[model samples]
Target: MKLVTLAIICVLMLNSCKNKSQEEPQNQVKVEKIEYASFGKEIVASDAIAAKSMASHYKTMKTGDSIDSKMVAKVNNVCQAKGCWMRLDLDDGNEVMVKFKDYGFFVPKDITGKEVIINGKAFVKEVSVDEQRHYAEDAGKSAEEIAKIIEPKRTYSFEADGVLVVQ
Candidate 1:
């Protein structure tokens, strides 16, 4: 009886391991952040100040402080559904949410961790719960997680007229 149970357990374990391996693609792409894009569409390089400088420029301001400027930054994340928005990484784990001006262009959904210079109006805004939920849905977050956004949150945001992604 003991030998039979051990054999059954080993078979089940082997099956589970096989299933897990099969679930992953053999050609799975490794994502990496870069000064130039490795996974998204190519673009000619242009110049802008570093992302740190943009953050520092507003160190003493409260929400609603707006600055019209161009800045270069790393793409932290993009909207998984439509590429309608992106989050730019800043110093100290901060991020600025960016949306295209007049819905003119959408950043590539796979441009995570690439560098780009954006010409835009940057400001801090209090994102309402409904807006937060909408973004969570756009990002493909689970319904349970979206439901947890009950309070407003303030963060840096941008409306970009043009963006030049580095090659």
Candidate 2:
């Protein structure tokens, strides 16, 4: 009986190790505070700065394209289901979904409407069928309900390598 107990303990320990190894990798993005240059220069709001930058970079971009740059935008909403994404409200009223490059970053739920800047790549693409289903599941929608929803014509996704939570 003692030998059997020891074997069971060893098995459980091994299983725990395996599960840890299978866990998703951490987000590698870094964050830093923005610096103000001088007192006389107009200190641009974070949303304003991000808007200008995104305009310059994404103006000529089309669907199915991608670009890497620093962007600023206001956090319109965040994912309440998984906290994996934040919806950005661009100055134009167009919204973009933003996600950390990995699972490493986090933002406070109350930060909605706050401006932020992040270094990352913006992807314009259509959601694949499988991807749509996966997202639906993550958003806590039932599979049957998700299947009945219409897919988007296109989507703008941002993958951030680093983020700055600006005021």
Best by TM-score: 1
Task: State residue 43's C-alpha deviation in candidate 2, in Å.
Answer: 18
State the TM-score for model 1: 0.70
Name model 1 segments beyond 4 Å from true. Answer: 1-47
Which one wins on lDDT?
Answer: 1
Worst 10 residues of 1 by lDDT: 36-45
Q: Give all TM-scores, in the order shown.
A: 0.70, 0.56
Residue 142 displacement in candidate 2 (angstroms): 12
Residue-level lDDT of model 1, residues 1-167, one tens digit each, is 99999999999999999998998886699887555432222333455677898888756557988988788898988999888999898765789899987886787888888788888788988999999899989988998999999999988898887777776
Lowest-lDDT window of 10 residues in candidate 2?
36-45
**What's the true lDDT of residue 101 in model 2?**
72
